[model samples]
Target: MKKLFFILLILNFAGCTSNEEVADRSQVNWQSIEKDLQSALILAEEGDTINIPGGYFKFEKSLLMDDKQNVVIAGAGMDETILSFKNQNEGAEGLKISQCKNITLVDFTVEDAAGDNIKVSDTDGITFRRLRAQWTGEVSETNGAYALYPVLCKNVLIEECIAIGSSDAGIYVGQSDSVIIRNNEAYRNVAGIESENSNFVEVYGNKAINNTGGILIFDLPGLTQYGEHIKVYDNLIQENNHRNFAPAGNIVGVVPPGTGLMILATRNVEVFNNQIIDNRTVGAAIVSYELVAAISEEEAVEADETQAGSAERINSDYELDENYNPHVGNIYFHDNNFQNSKWFATFQHDFGKLFNFKSPFNPPDIVFDGFMEAERSPAEILCIQEKQKLVFINLDAPNDLEDLNENIAPFVCD
Candidate 1:
């Protein structure tokens, strides 16, 4: 019988070349590979598969997988696994998964974690693939605060990830629900993909550059989930203008640094086909957590592009969430492509005054601090359509500059 079909094709090529990976061979024994990886997740079962045998690992604590269901902690990829907590002293995060269901964390890389590097809480069918979180010095306050952090999750799937140096939010999805952040690659950190108090999130083909603010959709003031249907599309968000190194009081440490796609107190957000450029100030900022909690750390470092940060000193005494609905209406900016952006937006502290008007065109690729929800209506449900050189501003509706109105016939709606 053809020698038993060549011995069953050499035992199916030796069982598909036996896979486990572990590169740069030999000489291992870090406390016996951390006591056999904490006894393989304390004796994992439900469809077990905990490979993890790549290289450098230093763990001081945190590496737990609690209440697991269909666990799968794979590695040997993200540049051949590297876990290091830079000498962590106990834990708050760095591979902490709780109440997991169909978990599948793959291709690891964590490095420098004093807190939050891969936190999955209250999970249910989670999947974070091609992971790689970092922070090798520079851009500090002791970088840590989120890098693939999934909170109160459910049906979450973050794909092809690669977040770097986060001092807060390098891909943070808090108080979650059904979310899907795709093709990620956030740089420097401090909000390069954030969706707090989450609900139905759908950030597309992400690539938020530089950092400080390239993709945020918040709804803070005590969570339990109050965020709405968010849908930012095909992103590329540019320049991001780094320099925010969060940590002084959290809430993205006062974001401002050429932002690109920010929407606080979220409510049915639906921005589309983005490309946003330069970003020296705001290429889409739309507030209302009472106008960023009433800005005042001296209005966040002057040069006031409509001052929005600095000094509520985070943890502003808690107390919020009696149903928490600080209003920010329908919001649905369309077909985006704004380039260069005023780059600074004519100072005064930085965001408003619409380039202090005096002609010279080009400003307003969306700002809207004019809070909204007096029932809301800037032409019914604010739906900007068929963009023709982005421009908009409702800083509280003060009109001038020849009453700027690029086709404002009720902002046309569906």
Candidate 2:
């Protein structure tokens, strides 16, 4: 039924461009737009420019580019140049660029692709500027997973872009290094901006609102890359209370609605100068991999046999890196204004099992799992100097109330 809705939704856009509009296309004399674009990409030389003239450039198939370098595909401003994939006939993405370098995809709009809107993988020195990627329809599970995705790349910069209505994440940087994503607007997605198994990145000056969660920095098991050294500051993270439409088995499936910001297993992260407000759940949470806490059935049974599932075991089958550092450390939060946030959503994964559900879910602005690497003193492991009137929880023990302390002495740091 959703697929049928997508077809009709795309048809509306396709149907809007009347025959008079089609007859007005005279910038490029091409029999097939997709083929012409493909040939242009292949024939492009080093430091060459492929300028897409101003008009509706629709495609029934994806545009695939691989092994190219020093090329730029520029269009008339994003509002003027429209690329529609309403009836995409082939491929998993609207545009897939791989094994390329110094590529720029800017000044265009890609609308209603069946899969990810733009996927750039195994490429370096990429820039996505002033572009819009969207699925124009009522928000639902049928939306694509990612709007602008860059994976396994280095030296990427994405700025001044707009993305909307992605089922999973609006802008996702995965297994990439040295990235800067700023000045982007994202909403109505499962996660607005997500960094997964990525390293050496900065995400600031972005507005993320009305999504399932905003600004998730996570390192899940079984991925080839490990996440570290990320900085998230000076962004508006608010009102991310959308429904959790993420499919099961994916690590993000555990994220409930109304999450403003969350960091799991990623180390060396700093979040400051961000306006966090009106998220119905906890404002922000930092947890270890053990707290993301994906336990297998066999492990669950063994724990149940011994003292209320309290016995710990070492499971090695699904480790990502050799060190397997599951604890979160070097996370600093300072000088941010947090307001109107509470335990906004219900929990689904191990977090629910470990947290006291009946206890006022969260009037607290910040929550932690009490599992740190102990690399620093109480002043450093997880430092928080941001002052806001809210409750704080330390779920070090599931049943012990003594372990929970309201004193702010343990968290204050410069």
Candidate 3:
């Protein structure tokens, strides 16, 4: 029995080494071989990395990555690799990752798509690093929905990417969890970064500037089922200057532009340590639509019309049903900096009024309390004479005055 066990252990060690060798051999150079897109697709198998060299590959239709695993499609760099789908007719997406796992798409620029720049659905463990997706043409019709969209995926990381001129959103994630979007730049789009019906999402260290809407967490009635448990922290969400870019029939109206950060019907959302500045409209707007208002009005009217001092009082009878009522619950906004906003901040409905506003945009003598005091951080003191209020912003760390001057000071219109 001891001899048999020793032989089994040796065989297992050899098998592991053989598997590692096979994995190393699977890596191939796509540029070394000359093949068309169709033949390249045929040659690509599981655990293969296709390196498209620095050139343009014109395709008639979208390149679909369907039901593959451990596949990497990379390029030399963002400036080098170009996938142009100018004549794509059917279901336009520059690259679609569907029903796959452990996929990596790095160092490429996907431009001029007939549809979305890159669309991923039902995939997991995906990383998009140092990529660029934009519309090359000034024509309004050339842009598409989302530069980088990961839907129904888990464990996604998007870093050092630039998304410009997307008709719908620069980066969009729906029905996903455990997503990290950091060190990305987005501009000239509808929503800079949008997450709908997703949970455990952290959007930090991003610059969302000159887009229509800076950053949005929304849950539309028809499209998404629920939205909860999101954190937006330390993002430079500023100057979303574009107009609404959605086509006539899309559902982007759920959260429109001129909104720096719009959280609609979402619960347990935390917004902290963000520098929201120079937006054309409201810096942060939170509201629910007509459904909640109608319900509240009906309850108020019924209470007003009831008889006085009766055993069955109308106020006691005015119980709101949780099914139809969509209320914003447990939203915590702490330790954020704000400056040069058009409307400053607007909380539309009564539900949004429940927030504890501490250390508002009042400068000169700025008060830092709550989480701001706990962290012992500096406050942003705006000393302009013309503005209505002296804006005092809270920060989690010491502000680099030089970096702030480089980015925000030059763009200050006033």
State every prediction's TM-score relative to the real structure: 0.35, 0.82, 0.66
User: For residues 76-95, could you state the per-residue lDDT of candidate 3 as single tens digits?
Assistant: 67765656665667667877
Give all candidates' CA lDDT scores.
0.70, 0.73, 0.59
Model 3 segments more than 4 A misplaced:
1-35, 139-142, 223-225, 254-257, 289-325, 341-414
Say which prediction, candidate 1 or candidate 2, comes out ahead on TM-score: 2
Clashes of 2: 4
**Model 1, position 321: C-alpha lDDT score:** 56
**lDDT of candidate 1 over 100-189, digit per residue (tens):** 799898987776777777888898889999888877657786677787888888999998878887887888888889999998888878
For residues 274-373, could you state the per-residue lDDT of candidate 2 as single tens digits? 9988776667887777755544435434534542111112233445456667777788898898886354344544443344353455545777767755
| TM-score head-to-head 2 vs 3, winner | 2
Best model per TM-score: 2
Models sorted by lDDT, best on top: 2, 1, 3
Query: CA lDDT of 372 in candidate 1?
Result: 54
Ordered from best to worst TM-score, the candidate numbers read 2, 3, 1
